[model samples]
Target chain A: MLTGMTAKEVAKMVKNKEDLFILDVRNQSDYQDWKIEGEKVSSINVPYFDLLDGVEGVLKQLPTDNKLLVVCAKEGSSKFVAEQLVEAGLQDVSYLEGGMKSWSEHLEQVLVYADEQLKVYQYLRMGKGCLSYMVISGEEALVVDPSRFTDVYMEAAKQEGAKITHIVDSHLHADHISGGKTLADQTGAAYYMMKSEGAVFDFMPFEEHDRIRFAHVDLRVLAVKTPGHTPGSVSFFVNDKLLFSGDTIFVGGLGRPDLGGKVQEWAKDLYDTVYEKIAAMADDVIVLPGHYANLDQEVNAAGYVGAELGAIRAGNELMNQQDKQAFVDQVVANAQTETPPNFEEIIAINRGVDVASPERQQELEIGPNRCALHHTH
Target chain B: MTSNKFLDAKGLACPMPIVRTKKAMNEMEANQVLEIHVTDKGFKNDLTAWTKSTGNELVKAEEEGDVLKFWIKKGE
Candidate 1:
């Protein structure tokens, strides 16, 4: 009988860098757009339609030495293919339980840092390449850039014997839906974002609150006034130790300032934020971001998706620039044409301008992450 | 505007929709039009890829409410 592997298990395999083979049965374009990816992970695609009659044509392509998993848009097709593979005498065949849909929603919690005052947990939404975090102190938790899974944060807080007291969005997120409002309401925690993002909901703006101090933690807020990735992109600087660099600075390069359709103007804001705003920050400060394009490349040995400010500055050209026009020109030229899927709707949802059913939200959030010009970015 | 054959894969999932479409396409005479109704939203992308790969012609595809509709012409 073929076994079913949960998304969490697959994430663990990828995290452990285990040798794994994937037989992806989703359509070519879908697979091209997104799929389970990792350093140790290798894959082949034979759309389930080709295997509808039987798994014979792909039998020769299946790997034998290590674990093999079949994946599809949903569990149905993968299971259908895997059952046949098992029936045909393949020893190690498993299907992703809820398929890519579930993979898209899985959150792998990894503790990035711990000190006497607080412990920071980075929630890697591995399938989506979106990262959120929770800072836990004495019976209090502060969440940053939460995904739609509000319960996960709530549960994590409960397990830590902490109540979520503060929630902050680094900026107006276009790549994925922000759980800022929903999570705040669910936990009765105060939510903070830039008012310039044009959110319909009323909340404490980052502009008003220079620092959000609760329990033993104090987080400094840096709100970019110009049209950044959006008009009001903000980065949270925590105790000068960790920088929650919204979409402004990523591990590889920088955020796509072109999402607002003002490539040059927004790129200039990104340049200023990099030079004027983040210039004084020390090298050792760990830089955590909202989205990651490539996990293996961005994730450190610490098993968290982040990098040191010095490493990012040393590696990316965008981060090292001194001239404003040159930086803007380079960013504009390197702009990515593909935006995240259904971003307009997602922005509306984030701003509380529009609402979506849970099912509709899931549908809108599917496909690959296109937040960066390149994963190289 | 009209199809010679209609397939109701409305409640079906992946592989099933494409499976039935392939079977129906095989049964049809050359150039015959088959209109398919599937509730799976991902079917829109899958149907296009399936037709292109199998040498069938996709005449039209659109979404109506929660269901996805497609018209395909059997390859000669």
Candidate 2:
């Protein structure tokens, strides 16, 4: 019998510096578009159809020294191929459990907080810097900043024995399509965003200082108006413990304020939010940001992509810059002119003004996320 | 039975089949049936719910091997 390895398991092996020979049986086009990327693992693309006639010819070419990992679109082809390889007298062989589909959609959920009353799971979207949160309080849960893969959140909520009660978007996202509306519609949860965002869709608009309460959960999420990344951006402070800083402040630095075409104005707002509002917050408060530039560096030992506000403030020089004019100048100077890929289309989709096919949305969000500030200083 | 339009959404993932179906239905006349073929396993539930919400009529849905075939009649 061939062993089945999940995408996460394979990722761990690669991280551990294990040599892996990944044989991808997906079609050439898909191989060209996107495939598993790892530091030590090497991959070879051979469409499963090519091996339909017989595996004898292909078997001779595969390396027997390293562990062979077979992968296909979903699992059927990869399993078939792995079985054939095992029958061919290969000593070690395994196939990806759900194949490339699972690999592409793999999400690593790390528990960020756990206490007597509440637990929070941060779903880290590997490769992409997008972060979604599930706050489980008793039998109720609230999802924050959900991506289009609603099933992940739904399943996570189910596993926690909680029903999704509310969905919230920090702002009108331009980097990726917001799943808030779709998820809310599916779960009958009240979807929320800042009323000032001018979203065409129907949602319960929340203002600053509004507390979102879940039934039977001793938790209250306070909406804090940040308004730096976008005019209506707001951060969620959960029970005064963790702050969901959505695109307003990242671990590396603050979110680039120039995405809205008003760099100077937005930069000023960002500076105020950073120096004025965020400065007043307790240093011990954990800051769970919306995006991270480098997962390898940003993710802490706890596996969550965040740190204490004191650490973030101490690490980021921009946070300590008291000169408001100089801060604005530096931010404006460091602002990137190149916009995120398909940002306009993504914004339109988030606003409920337009819709994109799944394939199109995937293509739009295929590249590395450029939502965070890349400037070192 | 004849259909007004045919959409082959096979091998496509979620929201693609629905997005294409919406576009095709927009160009179609009321009461015209749009035939769609898809391979994504989730499309069965997705399409059923989509049609219900949009007021379209799912005349027939049959599975032949791996492909799911659906005929949706446009609503006014």
Candidate 3:
């Protein structure tokens, strides 16, 4: 029997610099469009159909010395191919469980904070840099900025022995579908967003200084209005120890205020939020953001996407620009020319103005996330 | 199977096959049959579940070699 490995396990091996060869059995177009990427691992694409004629010729091309990682669109083809490889006398072969579908949709849960009163888990959507959080306090939990993979958050909440009580989107997500509504519907949790966003859906509108309390635990989540990325952007501060900065601020840089097409006006809002509101917060508070541009660089030693507010502010020059006009000019100069793919439709879906089939949703979000700036400075 | 429209989604991955099928179905009138050819192994399960939820009728599904073919009738 051929061994089976999960996407997470394979990712860990790749991260550890394992000398393994990835035998991608997916078609040429699919392989070219998207495949696993790692610093050290090498991949060779050989369509599974090509091997059906016979594996004798393909067997010679594969390296017998290194461990071979077989991959396909889904688990079926990879398993069939791996079986053939084993029969051909090659050892140390394993197929990726659920195949490339799982790889693209995998989420890595990193424990960011924990104590007797509260525990925070960050679900990093691997391929996309979207970050969602699960904060468990006693028997209740709150999910922030959930992705379309609602089951991941549900499973995490189940493992923590907590029921999802509330779900909130930091703002209207343009790049990807927000799982908040679906999660709320599934768990009967209260879903919230800012009323100023003009969403045509029903949600508990959160305003500045609104405190959410869990009955049993001593944790209190305070919503702070941090408009910049969007007009209704808000960041949740948990127990004054950790701040869910959302898209208003990222670890690499502040959220680009150009998405709404009113760059100058929104940039001013971003500048004030950065220089006035965020600056007034304690330097020691950990800032957990909504999105990350590069996981390899943004993920810290603890393997979570965040840093102290002081460190974040010190690293990003945009955060320290005291002159309002200069900050706006810099932001305008760096405004993204290319918008997120299907952003209008995504926004419409997020606002409950439109609906999409699951397949349609996946097609709209199938690519590298363009929500964050490169932060070259 | 006979159909009013044919979509060659073979070699396409998940979502693309379904996405293309949905687009094809949109242009077709109600009761019009749309045929799709898919190579992804998981397309069978996806189409079965998708048709059930979307109110479309899966007229016939057949497998030939590595390809899976389905005839779907558009819903009103």
Candidate 4:
């Protein structure tokens, strides 16, 4: 009996040509942005409500019922879907325990794309890849979405001789712990996110059209509500050039539609936001995603948000055909193979419930490798 | 009422057990006695802070078998 592969196992499988099916359950925009690569990789638009429907079809597509490794932007939904498949008589069904997000963090397997001046880190956690800004406007300065590893951001800031004056979380994340709070507290930098995300956390929140001005950097953090991924998910556009998409959009995939459990409503919202609000921006405006799929067997680290916004435009056929109904249809189809076992723990921690102490945090988080299943932020 | 109300909040995380105790205290009449059970290391400090901040009377607080028990009276 073949169980689900850990991120490490998945990495090995990618190296060796295996007859396994990698099923991606996140929405279309997310799938296009970043996806795990396999000659046999298949994408099913499964929203949470129509999760069973989505899984039934994917099951039909598999050959010989050997082992189907289900995947999603985050691990929670994919794990849920995998368990459901097992219940539905698919004996050899397994999912990436932490999903693709785990693959990015634990295995360090991510797809990266870059231009001469910028680079994007793809596929970090649950389609919520952190974006790092290493700009050399006046000095070698970095901004936004540092990891739990504070030293990385600190070192970058020091090397630039540029103080990190601002740290912004695109939204209150449900996957991966927010290193922003710690970064701000340590560096005396102003931590900012949309007012919606700000309501839940005890921090200084920035609203729409707020501009973060530093000595050499003038970043206009536009708070565009892209709430499919989470209730307070927002997209931040800096200087009308780079967009910091938290979980709202992905490189090859859209965020999980059933997030906040309003798949129908969120699907429509994503449609308007992406086609009208986001697509309306200049074609040159970079589309930085929260995470990307590591379908390419070559890359070992996810692309950064900054790298995404600069290059990944709406020119891709997936982005150009911005049909709201199609996106929703995909979401409705994919939700079945998407439920995970430990989503409640993730949601509780994300909502600031039952997390009053460090021990409580530890208890909720099973491991540091649980980048997608447990809400660290 | 003849019955004394007691609460056990030992070794529990914050915001949950504390919130429950507060709700229980609210339902009790004034001058009623309530006991809380806690085993978390920081419970002593948290409970003490809560008592001070809420103006409740802490009649007794003692450690027994790794559990910290607190006797509190409803504030006037």
Query: Against the correct fold, how does model 2 do in TM-score?
Result: 0.67
TM-score for predicted model 3 compared with the true structure: 0.74
Candidate 2 wrong stretches, greater than 4 Å: A1-5, A11-102, A215-232, A372-377, B1-76
- Those runs of model 3 whose alpha carbons end farther than 4 Å from true positions after fitting are A14-20, A25-34, A44-65, A75-90, A215-232, A373-377, B1-76
lDDT by residue for model 2 over A1-377, one digit each (tens)? 58999988876764455788888876566566456655567888876555654689788679988899998666777887788889989978999987665665567788999988889999877646678898899888999899889998999999989889989888888877888999999999889888767689888887642678775343333334454435625678877778888877787877776467878777777777777678888998888888877665677777678999999889888899569998888888888886676888888888988888887676567544567536334
Please give, for residues A1-377, the per-residue lDDT of candidate 3 as tens digits. Answer: 47999989876865565777889876666676557766567899876655654578788778888888899877777887888999988888999998876776778888999877888999887666789999998889999999989998898889989899989788889888999899999999998888767688778887642667774433333333455434625688777788898877888888776477877877777777777677888999999999887666677888788999999889888787569998888888887776777889999999899999997787677655677634423
Model 4 Cα lDDT, one tens digit per residue, A169-258: 666554445566667778887777665542355565665446765544566654445543344355666556666666566654455554
- The C-alpha local distance difference test score for the whole of candidate 3 amounts to 0.79
| TM-score, every prediction | 0.96, 0.67, 0.74, 0.49
Clashing pairs in 2: none
Model 3: lDDT of residue A6 = 94
Colliding residue pairs in candidate 3: none
Winner by TM-score = 1
Candidate 3, residue B15: Cα displacement in angstroms equals 16
Residue runs of model 1 more than 4 Å from their true location after superposition: A227-232, A373-377
For residues B1-76, write the lDDT of model 1, one tens digit per residue. Answer: 7899999999998878888888888889998999999999888888888888889899988878888888999887
DockQ scores of all models, one per candidate: 0.80, 0.03, 0.05, 0.02
Rank by TM-score, descending? 1, 3, 2, 4
Alpha-carbon RMSD of each model: 1.8, 11.3, 9.0, 15.5
Ranked candidates, highest DockQ first: 1, 3, 2, 4
